[model samples]
Target: MSSLRAYRQIVRRPSRKIYVGPVAVGGDAPISVQTMTNTLTTDVDGTLDQIRRSAAAGADIVRVSCPDEDSTKALKDIVAGSPVPIVADIHFHYRRAIEAAEAGAACLRINPGNIGSEDRVREVIKAAKDYGCSMRIGVNAGSLERDLLEQYGEPCPDAMVESARRHMRILEDNDFTNFKISVKASDVFLAVAAYQALADACDYPLHLGITEAGGLRGGTVKSSVGLGMLLWSGIGDTIRVSLSADPVEEVRVGYEILKSLDLRHRGVRVVSCPSCARQGFDVVKTVATLEERLAHIEEPISLSVIGCIVNGPGEARETDVGLTGGGGGSHMVYLAGNQDHKIGTEAMVDHLVALVEKKAAVLAAERAAARAAADEPK
Candidate 1:
């Protein structure tokens, strides 16, 4: 049997906190969720639209690529319109990095090794300081520096860490200290191992990711496994779940990973069973529909929709609201664990949605009152 002790706790690693705009990362800050906009940076409206959607999905920070002069020029408008802090992604072009900072980017994503001469790096660092922007030293297994690749014969954990240190040294040598690092790879083992090694080797905030994982389903699973290992061991500070689908999906997946580990909670977490022959209703369809309907509820709550009485009541006992199917056309409803009432199959979806919305409103008001009370000059 799995150890019960594993469920009780996770002591996060201690690292210096840094601000990516107003959002705090590392130290005691809540682990933040991030996603990158795939829309062309020069298409300011399109990029801002995507950023808004990602933010609505609970993204704390968003990254936009600035590959040329036009993209950097557009950064001014995108940053101005974005609801969350924007990180300008620049590769091999120090001019774009400098321009992005002056354009009001909260952070700059650049691999120092790829940005050319030391003088250029110092200039970029100077720009970051002038604009009060933090930086992300992103080192990927697929894009390790040429010298490090030749040194290790391939992209391995050691090589990725070496690449990260090289970049860190560049910033430190230039007296730049406000930065986080990510050593990412699509290979789960490589990414996990590299992150673990990187976490141990530095006190700087670590940005966790499994780069270029895949599409929605495949990428979610791969990132969960890789990020799960690191998070369970108390390693990650901020996270981005790399997916090829909509940028919103990346933010959703990142929150789900954090939710599963009890590190953070944002929206409704549904605990439903995989329908079996003994199921009382269409378990799979019900869950799919409920997730879509409940997406608008931002407050964290748990709801279990079990098919039959086998494990239904037991699972429901642990959730805020629950439903367990019965032999008749109706099913039992659970509120705060105990059986509250029953409802026919036809009314199940609508009834559950109403109950969840009501519960969310009550919780939100309670939180507001608590905040108000705490603010009293006591």
Candidate 2:
């Protein structure tokens, strides 16, 4: 079945794999979802609180900015408490990169070309090697190298790719291969073009994002359209959906993008139809309520909530649990694509929540049993 599923898959581009702590990126690994913390890094407790929330929301990696010595000083505690690996965002400061690596950061976000002299870059590489930390060469259009800006005359895709290559060359010169690269721009076209060019130019893992992509609504749409193109083409190894909203929302949106592509799965995915006048029950409110209630489920399962029987039965046949609204204030409930029972409007949301929770427990137990049997002696 898995092979049959792969037969219809989008063939991903081949790229070298690198590890950020225990999490792997590229080389056929599941595409990772990441989000940056907005809390001041020096506030260890506050930062850890946000990291915990993002991790709970399915962030594979969490980045915390290290703009000063104080932030680096607090990194040790944050790293110790964080459930997921931490990436220290360091720019223009070679010393902070070294400090962050020593403080147990899994990766350092830096551009070797912008962090002072060649000697400084080499020192940072040495620190990364010594402390078993990876690096991310982040090139942004808003902060292109002066020479590149002058040469290209603007923040174009060519300029962004050149900037990435320049930083990449510095890492290559130092023999540092444990790194990934991202070329981002606020403009969707520029960012997409830069990533496409970079993916063609190198075998290194490409991190995808459209930086500073507005607030919640705008950012989600922009990121979906841009990153969706890259992902469908098998370009991104990891992704960050940048937004001005809560960092957890970024994680959620990132997973949603991946889920839409069937690339990665976590939690309960609700397939709901836009409510219409043909509905039998309040489909909109039911979906909204069910989404919140099912957020705690980590197992990958599908639930379809349809307004009426027009497409409900077909969709229900493909999901683990489903609800299709019916006339006279009653609805149908499906278990494993088979009609198991009928539920009333008054008990709809609560009943679905109970059914899903029960289903999740069964799936989790089966997974655990399989793992246990696999570990038993032959």
Candidate 3:
């Protein structure tokens, strides 16, 4: 009922905008979510399958590794069939970078210096420009340039930023600016510090990540902490939660972080409580089930699944759909923030799923109508 305060807002950093296929990054664009495919690049069908699933999970961009000649050749089909833009990941292979560009990659994740020789760098850059592809200067703390490692004696924020600058200089020297940059480290502190320094040092869009972040659960927490701190400061332009899980989970986690920050919203935003002694239903299992069932609904909606009356009514007031557990093996359901009806536990999940589906359908029609209205001659 009240407007958000200034402190609740994220005033994003001003940086030059660039396009990865159709998605824009930086300079007033909605911060994008990216995930990398674990499938081998040469496995075209397998790679496309993963890309399709990741895109459905809300990945704005997907990167696939291109380690050799075979991978780049397979990239053409992968790019052609991909629903979202493809970023070809090239490390120490300028030829693969060029081939990826020629294969219709939307972006090349390549470091110019490591690709060997100024001429090779120029050729890769030429291919990128000629093929209408963008570039990403990816600097990972685990793989900082040898000279920088020697100079700094370790991987730290300074060394990371210096590596980014060195690569950034290569593109800048060639008068190329259609690119974004990332300085990632497995160490949260190092990654955050490096991103902070780089954010101040240049106006290039930053791709945030804690590289080599562990498995799903642990990696999610680690990335959330590091990325949350950076996003809270309005520093990152795009993010990838580098989890050692399905790339779809990475996209999901990326969106969750953005949703928590109020920077972006897609699909259901669940507000559930950890079960306690007074809970009326199985809160843990219910929330998990609801999340799995509602994953396909991309329309932004919020639902509150609380087990008892203590905080149930309060949370239900803020969400679109609310299920509050009550006695008599039945539960209370709230629609549009008002107490609406009751149903038995046997019918609860299905009933709530129907309510959300109906709500999402209505929301979709309203959006379509709004778009039609906007398109009409004024």
Candidate 4:
């Protein structure tokens, strides 16, 4: 146990623990993926539907903007119906934070600088403490305090770090330590630098993201670059890929980042070749179809869709399942690095999906058996 603890310490920063519903954040917990709903919070059914979708997409925590009375009032239904924990994003309104707490929010996201006065900040903290809810002091470059901007001329990395420290001080002064912090900037360099500075300055678990990261393609790349750097350096404890697209896409990107680092595995990882002149199949369309079909799958498996048989079998060795094209519209299937059989090109996708489903079922059963064995007698 001591050795295991030491290993964890070596891999991640040490920070106090906080719970958002049943999921743990900070020390020793697997880094979690989070996303915010774009739906109007007052639309309880719509918001709850988005929440359930985000949870199904493997979001460990979901946040909704609580900017008004209606949104706050709707929190009860959202929280009660959500599959995962909900965090209320309260800006400039301490009352909403209080209401969200009363309505069973698992966490409250508050920016102390914007929440009216010091007294208001304290009141929000008190509400959080009373309800046993965690808080996130989100410091965005777009909304840093004026004094810091005047002192630094812009929302530089230092200014962002200072802003986070200020909000953190407010929570600390109120003896409210059940909180995490995020210092986000639109610029990837600034966001990464600010997080690095904060990580050195304190032990609080860092919530990592590059805010307003454009649309699906642009935002995914931007977030992957920024969050990827922080996560690789062992700085982030929880992450949100702030894309201006469906919230579910954000959760998908978060897991991809974690999966790429071998830190966490929550879905199928499709590996395909870029296709060259020697290629034999329509690898592009096949890969797209496979990805679309496997988007919502939660099982962790590697599937390689190669274009030709020449280099395919060798590449397939690293994957759980694979397909390599044969001559004249035929294909060879490989399962767990072995040649399974041959099939027609038209039937390849369905065949691969069936093989994957079978493997996923067996994997699930093995996990259940192992868990049952562990819980039994010893």
Best-matching candidate per lDDT: 1
Regions of candidate 3 where Cα sits further than 4 Å from its true position: 1-4
Task: Give candidate 3's whole-model lDDT.
Answer: 0.93
Error of 2 at 13 (Å): 0.7
TM-scores of the models, in the given order?
0.97, 0.97, 0.98, 0.95
Global lDDT scores for all candidate models: 0.94, 0.94, 0.93, 0.89
lDDT of 2: 0.94
lDDT of 1 by residue, 1-378 (tens): 358766648999999999999999999999999999998899999999999999999999999999999999999999999999999999998999999999999999999988889999999999999999999999999988788889999999999998899899999988898999999999999999999999889999999999999999999999999999999999989999999999999998998899999999888999999999889999999999999999988999999999999999999999999999998778999999999999999999999999999999999999999999999998
Q: What's the TM for model 2?
A: 0.97
Flag clash pairs in model 1: none
In terms of lDDT, model 4 sits at 0.89
Ranked candidates (lDDT, high to low): 1, 2, 3, 4
Residue 101 Cα positional deviation in candidate 2, in Å, after optimal superposition: 0.6
Query: Per-residue lDDT for 182-280 in model 4, tens only?
Result: 999999999999999999999988888899999999999999999888887788899999988999999998999899877898779988989887677
Q: Give a tens-digit lDDT track for model 3, residues 232-289.
A: 9999999999998999999999999999999998999999989798787888988899
